[model samples]
Target chain A: MSVIVTPTTTGAAGAGDPTSTSPAPGAAPGAPAVRSRFTRGPGRWVVLVLVTVTALAVVAPFLLMLLNAFKSPSDYSTNGPLSLPTELYTQGLTTYWNQVNYPQKLLNSIVISGTVAVAATVISLLNAFALGIGRVKGRVWIIGLFLLANMLPQEALVYPLYFFAKQVGLYNTQLSVIIIFTVIQSAFGTYLLSSVLSTFPRSVLEAARLDGASRWQVLWRVIFPITRPTLSVLLIFFFIWTWNEFFIPLVMLISNSTQTVPVALATLQGDRLMDAPTTNAGALISLIPCVIFFLIFQRTLTRGVMAGAEK
Target chain B: MSTTTQTRRPHRTGTPRQSGQPRQPRPARRERSYWTYFLPGAVLFTAVIAIPLVYNIYLSLTRWSGIGTPKFVGLHQYTRLFSDELFWTSFRNSLAMIVAMVVVPTIIGLVLAAVLFDYLGRRFRGSVVSVLRATFYLPQILPVVVAGIVWGWILRPDGAVNAILDAVGLGSLAQDWLGDPSFALPTVMLVMVWVQIGYPVVIFMAALGRVDPELYEAAELDGAGWWARLRAITIPQIRPETYVVALTCTIAALKVFGPIFALTRGGPENTTNVPSYFAYTTFFKKLDVGYGAAIATVLTLIIVLVAAGFMVFQARAERKDA
Candidate 1:
């Protein structure tokens, strides 16, 4: 690594006088002259074009879906996708609502995602608090076990969990999805939160303890306030993860009424290749909550990253 | 003052031990408490996750159809998999996608982070970076079905990509992206990249921020150009994070079922049949529980090996740094 550092200084000195016969300091005899790649005129434009092209490529599908949601089925099928919709359409929405029971499914998704996020955050926060701040023994082993549990693929567990859920009579229930999502997410949450908490200054915690605060009270009053931003970031992340979860819900939630948005939208495709507009509408509806959350919590998300950076 | 006063005045009272000896250890109090912190998490982990992982290994060894009693068939499924053409094909496709999904996106993410970090100042950088990140992350937040539907519409024969190609008078280039066997896996890989790039970019940005500004200053003084500085300073600084992202992306790529299930269903002549999707079909569509378990077991092993490889690499890197 240090080998490259000297070349940089030589390159700078070389830039000052292109005709200089003398070797610059730190320059090896006959070393190649370093040039400023950033100063190359066409490269900047090329990078700009590349960034724009990549952004458009990434965003185009989403924009198409959003626009298609506003087109009638006939218009969507016949008209060019890039063209303006001939008429604004609510028919797709109506079809989506009726076919997928969109309202009920949306409610189920919200309830399941919400419950899972809350439960996972709470449980992980407790674990993080105990292990992070409580000076608990064997903390490294516990954390390692959590990581091991997380790394196991979901498919590996689906069959056994199916039987287990059935044995416990929780299969095909929203509770099953909630519990499954929560358990899977808690490991990640605990890891992130513990890292955040360990960075917290110990003197503040000690002050609380000396002031006659119990462990729980100190956690609630002191640690919670300090870590609120990290907690919120985790909350949004967990909510998004649970909302977007597929395989667990597919394996466990067997009935239409209990099906979340992903499963509901997936079943919409079977035997209905022509129903693009309605399926697009369902897809759009499924995305709105997450988009809203993203827009709202974007600050905390970046700040959390910045915090992790500082560590 | 309090400590001295207590030591001087406390002996006026009760027990024999209070005068001369130190107190006994608090064994009674320790015994009174249960290990409650481990209770809920441990139970859930063992029941929901751990047991199933163990059971999956067991199932991989049996010949059960998921209905009746299992016949003990040791290594039969494994032996069959050795000659399974579809398994190898899917494995190859998975390896291709892993490269596409992890390697390409990671480079793109690092470049994007570097560009944004260079171009934007601190305050504006923070806000703008998040907005940009949110755009990429939006697809990931949507259910795979939704994303699949959206991408399907965009990539259909006469869909958005074709429409754009037609509009630009390059109609010759337009093809049925998802329906074409040559294009199906690539299309799915593109979607996976689109869905995943935001995460790694965020991680990279975080890692980039940790890099000391003095290093950049030193590089500048040394006449290091942007690319040179990036190669020497930035890449090495973010190597650990890069490893983490690569490991996670590989695991995610291996286990990718939802998008494939939603979009291709391993179709266009099974060009996109990854091991996970193959396992899904084997169990659900074929009702071959043991075969499916064997595939799943292999995938689990691959992920574990990749993770271990990363950890070992990271440890070596750290040792060199030390």
Candidate 2:
């Protein structure tokens, strides 16, 4: 519920400095470690093999899930969860997919996550505009409040939120989740984005102001363009984080029609135990979009992960 | 980290140029209108965070069951908490979580990052090093619940791990990992270790990148072993990141819920129960919303105290380095 990790120092993440961002360690890595390539011949291979094995171990569960997702229940039972499927049996996939209306869950996830991303980024920009660029009085206390909000576990807030949603007729609606997550995710966005914006040059703002640019105009025309990259990073993160969320959605969206992917899968446990193959298939399906996102945004993600942690 | 904060600290309230007669009329008007920009966020924050926090804290002082009305229980819930054995177990599990999420991962991540950055990185093809780092970090990118579900599948009684054990004639060692009372918490801890390894690795590797390459070179030239170099240079160089990782992960460990929900739901006689999960069940399953709020209040207080302790420790550490 509270997995937001940031570089303790504010300016380090979005600062326009080459040395701060994490690069592929294999590609250039860093410099001046003279004769870094070890002269210890066979031992180096040992290290490489050992590291590769560890990596494989780290990813082994996903591999097992993938392999078994295509297996028929009979294959799993007969072969005892070890053998390759005699044939591609995707019935488990289709069965589980239809059973929980997987496509609906997928759509709900996409809609809720996407909406939260864009909306949270906008709110974060607005907040940062005041604190970072506008330099609002008592900004430190405000930023600290947002940070505390980010760190406060959802457990502390969930019951009241659930009660309120019911009172407002939002208990089972996607809009309820969106509203909650947009605010929560932006709590983090505000913290990180404000840190980046605090260093915004006075000269740039003054130049825009001298051009008769209104505060809104300067924000949209001047600051937004400059801060687009940071906003983009926040957008991607909010989408992924919201998609991965569990507890609130679990409590809020009880019906299958309203449940998101992970929540749907968890509800499967509540009713009756799913067969091995169906569970595997469901798990695999739930992770595919995330894996694809990882592949596509590898560089941005790699950069962003280090951005908040390195500084 | 200290340097950045220190430089920003002096011009706390307003800019240095505003020292005498303040700023120009245009600037002054602009500054005042900044409150408008803050209005939307302020409104949202109050509704979502501020209100709920105060409401939950108030609820902690009463007894409610999600119906009728909440009766004022005074400090009874707090007193009951002192005697609740389940409460103790939940906290004990949190300590174990800290071990799984922070202590072990940070140690392994430090070694792995060092080996990757210092040894395998320069010695081998870049592809191998990059591939390994990505693989280690792969789990970090997933919804932790998704990762937990997969591990649940693997560790089931007749699941992949047991099947592998049978295939290798080690079936005797196979057990129902999550179903067993004793093994449930440890199995969950082990799974958490897998889920957490990547975070520290990514942070530390990035921290290691900033280490002056000349320092490693100098140590090597002086005939220092890799272990010696790690102790003297690598650890000290990345101490700030270490502090960040420890602080963030400790709070995260204490707040852990998604994985417990997906994998065990604090089951098998509640051995794997955490305070977060306990609060959750008390609220929804057991219909003890007030007790849940009390539990939440306790957890939040502990997190606050722990975070404050870490900040003080970090400040002292920075002062020593200075």
List per-prediction Cα lDDT, in the order shown.
Answer: 0.71, 0.82
lDDT of 1 by residue, B217-255 (tens): 678779887799779988987776677778778878878
Worst 10-residue lDDT window, candidate 1 chain A: A1-10
A172-236 in candidate 1: lDDT tens per residue? Answer: 99998898888888887776565555545655765775676666677789887767656766677
DockQ for model 1? Answer: 0.22
> Ten residues in a row with the worst lDDT in model 2 chain A?
A8-17
lDDT of 2 by residue, A61-112 (tens): 9889988999999889988777889899999899888988888999999999
Residue pairs in steric clash, candidate 1? A8-B222, A8-B223, A8-B224, A9-B222, A12-B223
Q: For each model, chain A TM-score?
A: 0.79, 0.87
DockQ of 2: 0.44
Expressed as tens digits, the lDDT of each residue in B1-322 for candidate 2 is 3233544654454366434323544643544488899898899899888998899988999999988889998988999988999999999999999999999999999999888877776566555666787788788878888778778888899899898998899989999999999899999999999998987776777667667777977898898988999999999988988887899889989999999988898989999999999999999989988899999999999988898899899989888978
On lDDT, the candidate that comes out on top is 2
